[model samples]
Each structure stands twice: as C-alpha cells, then as structure tokens.
Target: MSASDWQKSSYCGEGESCIHIAHAAVDHTVRLTESGDPAGVILSATPHAFAALLDAVKENHA
Candidate 1:
C-alpha cells in the first residue's frame, strides 16, 4: 500500500502518538498500527469484531 492509503484522525489533536487505522480496499476489514512503530505490529479486525471492541471500550470508559 502507498503512504496515502494510511490515515490518522485529527481528533487526536497534536503531540499524540495515536495509532493509524485503514480499511482494506479488497476485504473492507480494519487495519491498526501505531505511528510510533509503523513497521512493528499490525492488528486486523473484521467489522463485527471491531464494533464489539468499540462497545467494550465505551463500557470500560463509562
């Protein structure tokens, strides 16, 4: 993938080492990787799994 395919949200503001998220053009799955370790680890999730993760995070934060 090209550099342009990767994206980060501006919601993080400045000085944040947030992870970058990109969706696969072929499978429509989510891809996750930290900016700090671009070549390190990558985590992929299906739409349903990702949604469940969001729900869990919201519940924990609440």
Candidate 2:
C-alpha cells in the first residue's frame, strides 16, 4: 500500500511517536505502524481483534 492509504490517529501529537492505521481490503486486515518507524516494522490485526483491543482500552479508561 502507499503512504497515502494510511491515516494518522487524531490523538497523535506533534512528535515522531504517532500512530498510523490503514485498512487492507485485499486480506481484510487492519494495519498499524508508528510514525517514528514507518519504514521499520508493521503490525496487522483482524478487524475483530482490533475491535476487541479498542473495547479493552475503553473499559480500562472507564
């Protein structure tokens, strides 16, 4: 995918340690990477897993 396909998180700060997320329509997976290491490694997760992670984060914050 191209860099244009990725979107920076709204919570991102004006620093290198920002989060970027993208969707892969081919395999139906959500991709994530850190702005500081955009060219380094990428992490892929299923939509369900990603949702679960968000839910857990929300629960903890609640």
Best by TM-score: 2
Q: What is the overall TM-score of model 1 with all chains considered together?
A: 0.71
| Top of the candidates by lDDT | 2
lDDT of each: 0.71, 0.82
Where in model 2 is the C-alpha error above 4 Å?
Answer: 36-41
Window of ten residues with lowest summed lDDT in model 1: 32-41
Q: Which residue pairs come into collision in candidate 2? A: none
Residue 28 miss distance in model 2 (angstroms): 0.8
Rate residue 32 of model 1 by lDDT.
74
User: Which residues of candidate 1, in runs, are more than 4 Å off?
Assistant: 10-16, 36-41
Candidate 1 local lDDT, 1-62, one digit each (tens): 45566677555656537777777778888777766343533788898998899899889999
> For residues 1-62, what per-residue lDDT tens digits would candidate 2 score against the true structure?
77777888899989757888888789999888887444643788999999998899899999
